[model samples]
Target: MAYDLAPASVMFADVADVESAEMEIVHWDGGISIVPSGPVITRDADGGELHRLP
Candidate 1:
């Protein structure tokens, strides 16, 4: 039997994104080269948001 990976990939990617914390920069790393991190949202490949996690 073969495993379907598309779903798994999406799950793992979201987990990584949230756990990665997108991190916080300190004085030693301060700058405007940052992307703010927030609540995780699951979406379809069409770019339509499906759910925003609480």
Candidate 2:
């Protein structure tokens, strides 16, 4: 997370991008978090799977 940027500013910017991209966001009773679906696999130069991110 970026401590320099205000939380609300980051959130609003991300929300705006999501809106423009037509992405989805989930609102829960506690708060909200949006996880882009599918397996985001990172590969090294050798084409080996290095990590899997959400």
Candidate 3:
């Protein structure tokens, strides 16, 4: 399962639009990492094939 990462208080002042967001599945050590291209609120788990946002 994946956990949510809260946004840092000190964010960019000149906030721009989000280009895109995606999830990545790492192969090494059988671990999973969620990488976001922009400022998002959620991520996906490693075991699942699809990502479901609430």
In terms of TM-score, the best-performing candidate is 1
For 5-51, candidate 2 gives per-residue lDDT tens digits of 22333232222233344434565444444444443443434566644
Instruction: Output the TM-score of candidate 3.
Output: 0.23
RMSD of each: 13.5, 10.9, 13.0
- What C-alpha lDDT values do all the predictions have? 0.37, 0.38, 0.34
Q: Per-residue lDDT tens digits of candidate 1, residues 1-54?
A: 111334323321132355566633232222212223655554445666655543
- Which residue pairs in candidate 3 have backbone atoms (N, alpha carbon, C) closer than 3 angstroms, thus clashing? none
Q: Pick the winner on TM-score between candidates 1 and 3.
A: 1
- What's model 1's overall lDDT? 0.37
Sort by TM-score, best first: what order?
1, 2, 3
**Best of the two (1, 2) by lDDT:** 2
Report the C-alpha lDDT of model 3 over 1-54, residue by residue, as the tens digit: 244334431111111244454444333333334454444343233333244332
Pull out the clashing pairs in model 1: none
Candidate 1 to truth, TM:
0.32
RMSD of 1: 13.5
